[model samples]
Target: MIRAILLGLAALACLAGAAGLWLTRAHPVEAARFEGLTGDAEAGQTLFTAAGCASCHHAPDAEGDARLVLAGGQRFPSEFGTFVAPNISPDPDAGIGGWSLTDFASAVIRGVSPEGAHYYPAFPYTAYTRLEDQDVADLWAFLQTLPESDAQSIPHEVAFPFNIRRAVGAWKLLYLRNEWIRPAESTELERGRTLVEALAHCGECHTPRDALGGLRTGAWLAGAPNPSGDGTIPSLRPEDLDWSASDIAYYLESGFTPDFDSAGGHMAAVVANFAQLTAADREAVAAYVKALPPE
Candidate 1:
């Protein structure tokens, strides 16, 4: 009886070890190709604004209210747990000042950090992955140009298993698709598609969730409830609203809905970021999104 029990225990241990090995070994392949690209500070500025980096990381209550400051104390709550945004200022000790361009690219595109830990999807790297190599490099350069902050980042208050970074390898295996955006046959529309995929990240808030909390592919950008602890983010479905392409473009750039009311919730921040984009790019996003089939 003792021998049988020991044998069963050994088998379970072996199985667990094998699973762990499989999961961790699946770390994303290193693609340092982006390191060769020359970054444009001008383009980076636009991308930063389009990506809304300041909304979560900058200290909204700071004395000077500087948009460049990275106080790193904002808390984002979700179904899993609360994730505090980190300080990305040029601070070598407290922020990402020490990060190489490759490190930044990996975090934005592959969802892995400089410490080789997986960032929770709540960081929105899922949408960021669509960014082009040059854009990622430019954004990194722009971040490095910011004033470094001494404020340390707060740890995420996620529960067990969720706090374990190794488990995230499995999550990435299940949901992350490491592919570049392909251009369509239409030049104008294809440019719009690329801009939407990279900058607008429309799918992040609009797509429905799956059983494991991953985005549902077929329902991309159809509309989902906001997970940002504010009010619900409404559907962008054409059938749900009478908004035209120009109306959507105007709203994105100005935070006004078709009803002439000011936008609220997280979308207000998104519109604030969109406001910095060029009229042409904003129009591209509007055209693509408005053309999406109704849910």
Candidate 2:
């Protein structure tokens, strides 16, 4: 009886040790690829708008050009909890002004902060993870040009276990891949794949996730229940859309379908972001979606 009891305790310890090892695994890809690359602030600014940095980081109700100041107080309500955006402005004290390009790139690309802690995926670094090294440098430089606000970062309100940021490392290990979730078919799709999967992060909203909050890549962009709102996020498979490439591109440009139906819900903000992209980029995205095999 004593021997059996001792073996049981030892087994439990081994199990706990293995679990800890899995949970603490890190995604430590090198950010030094951006090192020695000089960024063009003008180009970075364009990428910034494309990446929709202002959508969350901009101060509430900041209209027109005032959106350039990233004060980061916007609140995002989700099933997990309410998330508050953080300051990414250039202020040395309250913003990223003091951070090296390496520091900024590390967080944006790998979701690892300068302090080496795992950042909550709410920051959308998973999509940013696919950004080109040059783009990262340019984006960081452009961020430096933005006006800084000293607004205090608001804490995200989440329940127990979810509140533990360290656990995010495990989640990243499971879901945070830096490659295409769906295989690309043609060269034409390569550009759109980069835009849709990387900067736009359309899948982050459209793709259904498991209970653990990892994206259901098998469904790809087949839609999910909206986490921030009370409706379903419609799927984007070609059969789901059934529209020609021109139709998709036009809707992206004007937010109006060929049938005169307008974009609504969270898609309004997404449409606004798409409207800012170049005409060719919109066409490319539409082409990519049009080329998809319907589910």
Candidate 3:
């Protein structure tokens, strides 16, 4: 009887190990969609701005034209640990110059690396995963156009079990999906939805998370404590927003609300990115925000 019990336990352990391996397997997007698309560098620049790549990739003090230099040393403080952005310059030895277009797309859209490793979500691929294949292609082209910088990537400061990057595969299995989050009723709303849910990744800041740091899908974009763990990020629901579509657009464009209240704190940086976009884009984003359910 004792021998039988031990055998049963051993069999269960083997099953558990197999399950773990399967759950953590690398799953990449299909190449059929990403292949053969010629990217336009001019249009790619706009996408880059909308995606706010410079906000994280550029050196913290980079200003004006210097923002174009993608040396990538910005520090992000989080409960898991601090993440240092990587150098994405065109340097063959030190930057992403070694990366193939497929490699780039896989990393940006699937959160998987060329070596089949999962990337920490700090890179915002969760939101970027919403990007169309063509958009990813264009973003890749624009990144290639950036000047070469020989700066090596600063390593992440994650501690203990959190530092075990392989464990992130299970997290990806739970939270990562390539599909659109909600159905859209119109072209305007759809356009805005893509920006808010995808490139803008608004929920990364506004939405609360579970104990494991995954976004709380039920709450969606409802307010939560900031990732930095200080002040709270405001809810973007229609009721909480308290702004007309026009007001929201105006704020996005000029950082000024109907009452002339200027955007402050982290929103200031967000506003800076939005200001680079055309008037139509801002209006679309505003319209989408106004249409959300009052949560």
Candidate 4:
């Protein structure tokens, strides 16, 4: 009887190990989807700005033309830990200079690194997963045009099991749905949806998150506690904003509220970036925000 009990325990152990492996497997985007696609750097420039790539990857305090340099080392503190952004510059040794278009697309849209490891959600590839194929190709072309940086990536300051990058695969499995929060019936609204949901990743900040760090999709843009712990991120729902579409568009372009108060803190940089976009794009974003369900 004791021998049979030992054999049963061994069987359970093997089953548990198999379950773990299946749960943690990396699922990268297939390479075949990118065949024959050519990147357009000029078009990519617009997508890059909308995606806010430089906002996290650029050297802190870099000003003027220096902001274009992608020597990354910005620290973001969260419930998980402090996540240090990596150098995404064209440096052959320290950055992604050697990566192919497939490598880039997989990392951006699927959160799978070139080494076939899962990237932490701090990179925000969850929203980026919705990016159109051509947009990803265009962004790849634009990245190659940037100046190279030799800065080595700073490792994240996570503790225990959280530091295990493979564990992120489970997190992705739970949270990585590519569905849009809101549907659009018009072309302009569709453009706005792409900009808001895919490129801008606005929901990453505005939507509340669950205890395990998965976004609370039911809340959508109903505002969240600032991870920085200063205050709420402010709901973008129509009732909370209480502004006309034009008012929101003006705020995005000029950083000024309807009351004429200038935007401060992190929003200042966001306004600066949005200012580079076309007037119609800003209007579309505003229209989309106004169309959101009330909190």
Among the numbered candidates, top lDDT falls to 4
TM-score of 2: 0.91
For candidate 4, the TM-score is 0.97
lDDT by residue (209-267, candidate 2, tens digit) is 89988888888889899888788988989767777888889898889987979999757
Give the clash total for candidate 2.
0
Scored against the true structure, residue 281 in model 1 reaches a CA lDDT of 75
**Tens-place lDDT digits, model 1, residues 1-295:** 9999999999999999998767764343266686468788777888888777887788755543486697678888878889898888888889988877888888888888877788888877777877778888888878877788989998999998688877777888887774533344565566677666656566777777886678886776667777875556566667766788889889988888778999877687788788877788778777776666765
- The best candidate by TM-score is 4
For each candidate, the alpha-carbon lDDT, in order, equals 0.76, 0.84, 0.87, 0.90
Which scores better on lDDT, 3 or 4? 4
> Candidate 4, residue 229: CA error in Å?
1.9
> Which stretches of model 2 miss by more than 4 angstroms?
1-31, 185-187
lDDT of 4 by residue, 1-295 (tens): 9999999999999998889888888887788989779999999999999889998899989988888889999888898999999999999889999999999999999999999999989898999999889999999999999999999999989998798887898898899988888988788889899989999899988899999999999889889998877788988887777989999899999999999999876778788889999999999998898788775
lDDT, residue 117, model 3: 85
> Per-residue lDDT for 134-209 in model 3, tens only?
8988888898999888988999999999998879999998888777766789998898998889988888898889
Worst lDDT 10-window in candidate 4: 263-272
